[model samples]
Every structure is written in structure tokens, then in C-alpha cells.
Target: MSRHRRQRGGPTFARAATLLQITKLVEFPAVFLSSIVQANVLPSRQYGQLVVDLSIAFIAATVMSLGVEESLQRALAANPRDRAIWTEALASRAFVGLALTLLAGILLVCDQTSLAIVGCIVVANSIYDLVVAQTASLLRPAVPSIFNIAAVIAASSATLLVRPSSSISCLTITLIFSSLRTAGCVLLSCRLLKPVRLSFRDAVRMPNLADRGWRPLVDLTVYRLTNNILNRQGDLIIAGIVAVDKTSVGTYALAFSLTTAANTVFLTGIGSMTLTRFSATYAESGKFELGKSWQRMTYLTAFLSSWPLAILIAIGPGLSVILFHGKYPGLALYLVLIGVVAWLGRISGGGANIAVLFTLRNEKLVRKVFLMAAAMNVATDFVLMPLIGMYGAIVGTMIGTFFSSRFLNVQIRRRTRSSVEWSPLLLLSCLTAIVTAPVALLHRSFTLSICAVVVSLCLWATFSWRSSICPPEISSRVHDVFGKKSSVGTD
Candidate 1:
């Protein structure tokens, strides 16, 4: 029976992951192109301010969320037809949005239009996040992914048409598109599930609506808040506080943006799918199946992430020069440092660990790990930023990522009592480092960089195919694509 269940679950999970990846592939280029346009059109200082505002808005949205989105996702995964949970979560988000709108109005009345704009953005982002979470929990991420892609393309086209010259103008355009995105998501979700009438009363009654108990919800909220702050906006916030000028902040922001783009394109989809699938697996089959799922996702994420890191290392310098007109100094080094941090986190199985822990309902441990890492990240930034400037932020993030990821892996191993097969991850990491090192040295040579990327990817593919580093299903699929037979066995 267990084997039968595994066989049934594997294909469903793979199809979902594949759909999400296709969505990201469509969305990433639009987002990357938009960043390039903004960087070229806006002055460095203005772009820096723009980055600061967006960061603040996102951080604020996470705070306002109160972790309800994630809590709802977990709940829905276990009980997908739970209408009460869905209604309460929607009401909570609506209430938060209303409060932010009121705050925006007050800010505008006080003549703080810049802050007002940010307040509005916070509302839009928060609502969008909740709606997307709702769809993802229902195991239908493609719906929101499609709308999100549309939003990005529309916003980018509008930006190109208007060609905003200042931070405020750019932000205003962003707010407009962001609101539209939120509306589209909400509309789509309504079609999928019954639309609940939201009121301030439901918001006031949210505490009492914790049908599963409040402690878990609160713990999840806290964990998510800290994790979001550390991962999303920590460096920029610290850089803004410690840097001498906005240009430095903007430079770091641009570098981080490129790394983030890579992450969004390659990892975000799989990570989301992993959480939902892991939650379902845990509910149905317990930790044994959960451990198997984690190993598969870890290997898959590492393999997919390696391609972007290789490309970035090989051609990032020339790409930066062409895209940003060589305006941002030290861009290449920042890319490599931040990119390594992301790659390290993946190979360390950080994302899979978090998903597994969440599925196991170990929120308190996750919260503690994230809080400690957040503190370390902030402390490192404060101590090093004044002395070393932007590099301090990069180093701080690297330290925080390393510690949190390693700690989480240890906890996961203890709880599951399942040993991780690290050979594949180690092999991939070593090969990636070796092949990309020469390209990094010759990053200035565009021809060599291009050739190196092709060579590196071919090597990765050949080695992975021969050694069966990829998950068995993936390997077999590749075999089918090439009209060959796979000798790989199922887990």
C-alpha cells in the first residue's frame, strides 16, 4: 500500500512542479527586463530610493500578514475543503488591507506622500501574497502564476511606455500595477472557491476563529515574519541605515536583484510545490515519506540552481556592463558573493528542511532558528557595514544563511532519523565550483564566457546523466526525451 501511494503521488507532484517551473520561466524574463529598464532610465540614487521604498513596503506587508497566509496554506493542505479557514483568512487579509489604506490616507493628509505611496504598496503586496497562498494551498498554483506573469508583463510595458524619470513616478506606476495584480488574483480565486463576504467584524473575530488552536498559528506567524525579514529585506534595510549614500545602497540592491531573479526563476516554484506536497505526504504517510520527498526536492533544487549560478559566474560581468551601462561598480563581485550565498543555502538543504519542519508542525523550532539567524545577520551588518560598506551586508547574509541552513538540517535529521544522501549534492557543488572558477577569471572576455557557460552546462548534464544525480523520475524522463532507456530505480 505504501509503495502504491508513493507511485501515485510521485507523478502528481512532478506535474505540479513542472507547471510551476514553466510559469516561472515565462515570468522571470519579464521581471529581469523590467529591472534592467529601470536601472538604465533612473539615476542611481533614484533607483536606490526606489529599491528602499519597495523593500520597506514588502517588509511591512509581511508584518501586516501576521502569518495567516502560511497558516491557511498548512490548514488547507490537510483539509482542502475547509471553507471556514478560507473565509477567515480572506477576512484577515482584507482587514489588513483596509487598515493600510486608511493609514495611507492619513499619511497623505499629513503631506507625507512618499510614505503614503509605500503604505498603498504594502496593502497591494499583502493582498497579492494572501491570494497567491490560497491558490497554492489548493494545489493549483498555475492560476496565480499566470496572473502574476500577466501583471509583470503589463507593468513592464507600462514602465517602458511612460519611462518614468524619478523614484516617485516609478513607485506610483508600480502601485497601480500592483493593485491590478491583486485584483486579478482575488477574482481568479473567487472563481475557484466560493467568495466569502468580508467585514470588519470577521477581522475582529479572527482570534476566536482559530479552530485548530492559536498557538500553532501564532508560532507559524512569528517564524514566517522573522524568516521573511531576514531573507527578503535584511540587507537593503541594513545598507540603507549604514551606507554613506543612496548610490551604494542602489548598487547593492541591483546586485541583490539579479541574484533574487535567479532564485525566483529557479527555486521559488519548486519550494512552494515542495511545501504543499510535503504537507500532504506527511498528513497521509508520516515522516518516512516526508523524508524521501525532502531528499528528492533537495537534489532537484541543487541541480536546477547550479545552472543559474554557473551562467552568472561565467557571463555576469559582461552582462552587467551591457545591461546597466557599467554604472554600478563592483557589481560582478556582489553578484558572485550573493549568488554563492543562495547556492550554499540550496546545497545545504535549507529550503527543504524548512518545508519538512513546517509539514511536521515544528514551528517553534523553526522560529528559534530564524530569530537567531536574523539577529546574527543584523549584528554582522551593523559591525561590518561601517568598516567595509556594502560588502558587509553580503557577508552578513552569507553568515546568516550558512548558520540557519546548517542548524535546520541538523534538526531535520534528528527529528526524522533519516540520513541525507549528500554525495550527489557534494558532487554537483564541486563540479560547479571547478567549472565556473576559470570563467570567473575570464569574465571580461565575452566570447570565452559564452563558450564556458555552454561547456559548463554540458559537463553538468553529462555528469548528472551518467551518475544518476538527478531524481530517478527526472532521469527516466530525460532518457525518454533522448529515446534511451533509464536504468535508474525508484526510491
Candidate 2:
């Protein structure tokens, strides 16, 4: 019976992991579509204002979250039946949500109507995000993802139908759709996942963090918040300081959204698979196998992400015009510059550290690295944005990512005493250079650019295969396809 259980465990885990990956990847299209529709349909100023409001709401949600979601996931993983902890987390979240709501109400008196509406949705989404996080930790992520997909479709359809003509109308529609999505997430959490429902009694009881230690919770929360500020909050930063003109903000937002599509669909979704594999590998062999696993995962992610990113940097301008209806001039150039910065950010973004540290349960180290990185980000943004306009934010993001990646390396070495190899990134950079240089040297001919990309990808694949960086399955298939040719040619 035990043997059967072990056999079943492998397949079951794989299935669940696959589902989660699919969920994230599938969610991307709906999200990207919604952004596209919103960008095209709304007037430029309205869309820019909407981005600013949403950004503020997200910041509020991050604060009000109070790190409970991360703490809850860890606590539940340690003791799944610990109802007290679950209740405590739920109660804390409820209180924070209420406080935020009250603050939002006060904003109405202050005439910050847009922010107030956004605050309501933020509160709802924060709870919903917590539930989804819980479900993912419970290894049944598909349930919430299903509800998320439904909500997105419904929201997008409604937004499109309404075609909000003004900023206020758009904000109202956004609030309504966001609330509906939250409701769907909550219902699915209760019905499908059978979450521990927290009563008013449970909602008020605070946990004693002194006894259990709040280090992990604080580390993860600060890391996530700071990371978001650096990477994902560019539109907000532009709205606040970098670009005062709504059209400029709107243009940057549109281009950034396009880059996010690449991240969501390809880079991030695929990256999660490595985290799962690393966790299992560490559990089985501890630090002995972790170094190699980390290296392989990093190389694999670099290989997978390099081409699409290079493609984006190469063809982003033309693609932007075609996709977004050419509302903003110079958008293509903005897309290219942002795409390069984003790709650099993605490659050097320290997924290996995240996977390894989380596996080692060294949350404190992770937190410290991110905190420093966040500081670097803030300082860089302030200096650069004042000097270089919107490009300053992009440059700051790139530099901030470099700092974070460097600190992550330092932590990994202190713990494992092993150095991570840079050959993979060097190789990827070489490939990108090969692909993009010709396009820059030659005049803007779409056909030549496409040929350069295809040829560069072929070269990259061949080089990776020769270097043994290609996965075993792909290598095997390649050998089978080419083996007969080599033998026949020799004859």
C-alpha cells in the first residue's frame, strides 16, 4: 500500500504542477486581451489615469496584506490542520481590509473619488489573492484559476460593451468588474477548495508572532512589495513623477503592457516549473544536489526566455503599431527600449535564488537581499527620472535588477559555497547580439529582420545542443532526426 502511494504521488504532483502552469499561461491571454481592449478603447488620458489609480490601489493592497498570505502558506504547509493559525490570518486580513475600506471612505470626503473606488476593489482583490495563494499552496491551484479565467472573460466583455467614454465611467466599470472577479474567486475558494471559513470570532483573534517568529513573513512581504515597485509599478512611477503628460504616460503604459504579455505567457509561467523541480530535488538530496539543479534551471530559463525577448526587442515597434492601432507615435521605439530593459530584468531576476532559498527555508536572506535591491531601485529612479524622462525608469529597473541579482548570488554563495556559472547568460547575450546587430546595421526591411531572427535561433539551438545545455528529451529527438543524415553523408 505504501509503495502504491509513493508511485501515485509522483504522477499526482506532476499533474497538479502542470495544471498550475497552464492556469498561469492561460490567464495571460485574458489579461493581455483586457489590457489591449482597455488601451485601445479608452481615450489616452483616461487610460493613463486608470493606470495610476490601479497602481495606487495595488500599493494599498500590498500594505494591508500585512504579510499574512506568505505566513499562512508557510504555516499551513508545516501543519495543515492548524486551524488556529488559519483563523488568525483570516481575522488579521479582515481587520486590515476593513481599515482600508474606512480610509477609502474618508478619501471620498477629500474628493479622491477615483482612489476611493479603487481602494474598495483593492481590498476585495487582496482577500481574493490570499485565497488563491492558499489554494496554490494546497496544491489545487487550478480551482481558483478556473474562476479567475471566467471572471476575466466576463469583465473584458462588459468593459468592451460599455466602451467607457470618460475617466470616471471607466473607473466605475473597472470597479464593478474587479468586484465581480473577487466574488468569483471567493465563491470558488469556498465551494471547490473547501477553505476553512473564518467566523467573526476567528476574524478578530491575532496570532502571537513572538512565539513563532515573524521573520519569514516579513521577509517575503517586503521582498514582494519592493520587487513590484521596481519591476511592475513603472506606469505608476511615470504618472507620479517621470512623465506629467497623460499621453506620454499612456504610451509608455501601452508599451509596457505588451512586454508584460511576453512575461506572463512565456517567462514566468515556464519559470514556475523550475521552482517545483528544485523543491523536490532539494527535498530528496538537500544542498548536495541543489547547486546543480539551480545551475540547470537558470540555464534552462535563460534559453527559453532569450529568443522571445530578443524577438520583442527586435520587432517591438512594428508589432506595437500593428497590435495597438498606432494611437501613439514613437510607440515602436518605446517598445523596443522597454523590451530590452525588461528582457535584461527577466534573465537576471534571480529565480534560482528564490527556488533555492525557499527550498532551504532561508527566507531572511532572501528578504535582506530584496530590501537592499529595493532601496537601490528607489534611489536610482529618483535620480534618473528627473534627468532622462521616461527612459530613466527603464534604466533604473535594469540597474535595480542587477543589484538584486548580485545580492542573491552573494547569499547563495554564503550558504552553498558554490559559485553560479555565467556562461549561459553570456551565451544568451551572444545570441541576442547576433540577432539584433544585423537588423540595426541594415535599413528597416521587415523580411531581412525576420530572416536574421530565424537564422540566429537556429544557430542558438545548434550551439546549445553541442554544449549539452539542451534538455535530454530535446537532445534525444534532435539526434533521432539527424542521425540517419550523418550516416548517409559519411557513406
Candidate 3:
């Protein structure tokens, strides 16, 4: 009945879940700092520039990373000793990071904002990857989130004082500094590996050539590439099509920043546990229960996300008006959508993605999937944005994600002889849709808030009744999450 214990899985789940919760706690700081940034520091022009910079940087970092971060995750089984990964991962990252930094500097000098942004993102992200890989090798999830929070707090404090008008430069500088901080923290925390000093011997021990997971690496690479294009391409589009207004850009960036904060919930809680569960589940029962567990997890996410999302969509306008000083006038509407996006991320199947990312040989299809989706996403954005604005980019994103999931699901079926339960998904989707309607349309925050409470109570009661009748096999797991607070499935 432990929260970390699934029907089957290793002891690592406890560490993983704890790490996730710790990471989730960091979201509080991230969100809080972002609000401050939007309210006081980031103007439209500065914010817009940050987006352009991030979009470019993210793409570069992703390319240079070449799925190495994921490779670390996928290769956990083969390299359980966690020896050479740090050295090799760091060296590889260093090479990519330097190249990208130089490239960004050149682009900046040449006045190519987008290209410079991309290069900056790449270098910054590479530092982040190296830190993350080392942390994971230490097999300590909490370390990563802890590093993340510390780094953010430090960066925000430094940047807030300077409060530079140029967000792009400030952001890039903070990122580099933060990455260094994270690396130091992660290295220090790795008591298990007893990390030898970074030297010739460390370099020799950290092998760059891991042969086991190239196939899965390809899959992961492609998936991330396409997903990023879908999610991060907006800055480019905004810069190109819009009037290059910084305030407009800043408002949107602030909204997206908030969204990123919101999405951390899924990353820490769902993604962390789901990945751990997959490791355990595959080891325990092949793929049979994976599908069922996936369905159940998806349902739980649907319910959990719905209430907060409803509140956001309902009260968002009022909150924005009061809190933001029209810095981001209608940001609440976008925030609601962002919450939906965050919640939808839960369905991306942590296990399947991990399995595919680790494959050294069978990853060709995954690469193809990424390339095709990226192409299609760009095409959709190109076609849609002129007509529909930012939502057009979202459309492109939806198309790409739908394809990715369908592709992953196909692989899932072939591997495990299991299928997604479309019926329940559809049912919940419909219920969420109906429940979300009043919040979207009803402007009165108090009324909507009251309605939301009533609806949540009703839904919980119904879910509780269903669980009693069916008798959840994983009822014990509920005790761990709720502890003495309360659990839905348990009597």
C-alpha cells in the first residue's frame, strides 16, 4: 500500500516518487518568480525577445543533445553501476555546448536574433542535460528538483536586482550560471557513485560510446524534435507575422511561462511515477497490465486536472486583472488552455517512450516518426497561423502529438498485446468537456467557484462508489499518496 509500490516494480519507485514531489514543490517557486517577472520586469518587447531566443536555443540544444539525456534514462539497465556516464555525458555535452555558444555569439553579432536565440538555448540546455544525467545516475530524483529550485531562486534573485530590460541576454546568462550551479549540486549529491575527481582517469572511465540503446535513442530524438517544434515554434511565428511588438510578446511569454510551471505537475508527479512503474511493470507482467495501468492513470489525471482547470478558466480573467495590472490582460484564458495542455501530457505514455528511447537498433521508426511529425507540424503552422493566430500553432501541435501517441500506441500494441481503452477516455473527455463549459462561459468567479466545488464533490462521490463496487487491486497504493489525509479507493 505504499505510494511508491505499484502492483509490481522495484524499490526505486520510492526515490523516484519522492524526487517527483520535491520537483513539484519547486514549481511553487518557479511560478512565483515568474509572476514577479511578468508583473515587474518583463515588458512586451523584452518578453518577445526571450521567446525568440528560447525557440532557437531549445532547437539547438535538442539537436546537440541528440537524445543523450533520454539515452541516460534508457540505458539505466545496462549501466546500473553509473560509472562512465557522467564523464562521457559531460564531455559530449561540453563539446556541443561550446559549439552552440560560439554559434549563438556569432548569430548575435550578425543580428540574427532567432539564430542567436537557438544557439543560446542549445548551449544552456546542454549544461542542463549534463547536470540531469549526472543526477539520475546518482539514482536520486530529489536531487534534480532540489538543484532546480536552488538554481532558479539564485538566478531570479540575481536577475531581479539587475532587472535588465533585455530579457534574452539576462535569461541566457542566468541559464548558464544556473546550469553550472546544478552541475555542482548534482556532482556533490552523487554519494553513491562516489564521483572521482574530474580528471584523466574520470574521463577514461566515462565512456562516450554506449552501444546498447541507439535504436531507442533515435526514437526519443525524433519524438522530442517534433514535440519541440510543435510547442516552441510559436515564438518564431509571432516574431515573423506579428508587428514585432515586445509587450505583446512579453504577455504571451508570461502566459506560456505560467503554462510551463503548470505543466511541471505532470512532469514531476505523473511522468516520474509512470516511468518508474513502466520499469517495474515490464519486469513484472510484460505489457498486459501496462495498458490497464495507463488507462487508470489517465482517468485519475483527467479528474485531478479538471477541477483546477475549471477554476482557472472561470476565475482566470479576474485574477489576471487584479494580479497582472493588464500586463497580460486576458492571460487567464490561455492559462486554462495551458492547464489542458499540461494535463494532456500525462497521456504521453512514459513507459513506451522510455522503452523506445533506449533501443539502439529498433529506433529507426521513431526517427521517422519525429521527422514526419516535425514536417507536418511546420506545414500546419504555416497554413493555419495566418488565419487563426496562436491557436493555429496549437492546431499544429495537436496534429503532431496525436500522431506521436498513435505511433507510440501502435508500438505498444505490437510489443504488449494491449490496446488503449478508447471508451473510458472518450467518456472522461466528454465529462470534462461538459464540466469545463460553465467555467469558460460563466464570468462570475464566485458562482463558478461554488459550482466547481459542487461538481468535484459529485464526481468524487461517483468515483468512490465505482471503486467500492470494482475493488481496486491497487487500493494499497492509494494509502501511500494520501497517507492519513484520505484516499478515494480505500474504505
Predicted candidate 3 versus true structure: per-residue lDDT over 206-260, tens digit per residue: 2323544455445656666666675755434444544444444455556666666
Model 3, residue 101: C-alpha shift (Å): 7.9
TM-score of each: 0.84, 0.75, 0.73
For model 2, residues 246-329, the per-residue Cα lDDT tens digits are: 555556666677776665554543443445455556655677677766665556566666776666656655565565556676
Alpha-carbon deviation at 226 in model 2, angstroms: 2.1
Residue 392 error, candidate 1, Å: 0.8
Indicate the residue-level lDDT of 172 in model 3: 54
Worst 10 residues of 3 by lDDT: 2-11
lDDT of each: 0.68, 0.60, 0.52
- Model 1, range 1-491, lDDT digits (tens) per residue? 54555453323556655665666677666556545544443234443565566566665665676656556567656655556656665555655555666676666677555456557645665676556545554445666777777777776676667654454555555566566665664465355345555455754344422676777667767776676556636666666566545556656666777787777776655766566668777888888878877877777888888877887888777776876677878788778878888888888887788888878878788888889998998898889988888788778888888899889988887887765677866776677778777877855778888777777777777777777667775787888889987667444
Question: Which has the greatest TM-score?
Answer: 1
Error of 1 at 406 (Å): 0.4
Runs in model 1 with CA error above 4 Å? 1-11, 33-59, 81-126, 129-146, 193-212, 443-448, 485-491
Over 4 Å off, model 3: 1-15, 31-56, 78-146, 176-180, 183-186, 189-209, 212-219, 234-249, 272-308, 341-345, 348-362, 429-440, 444-491
Cα lDDT for residue 391, model 2? 65
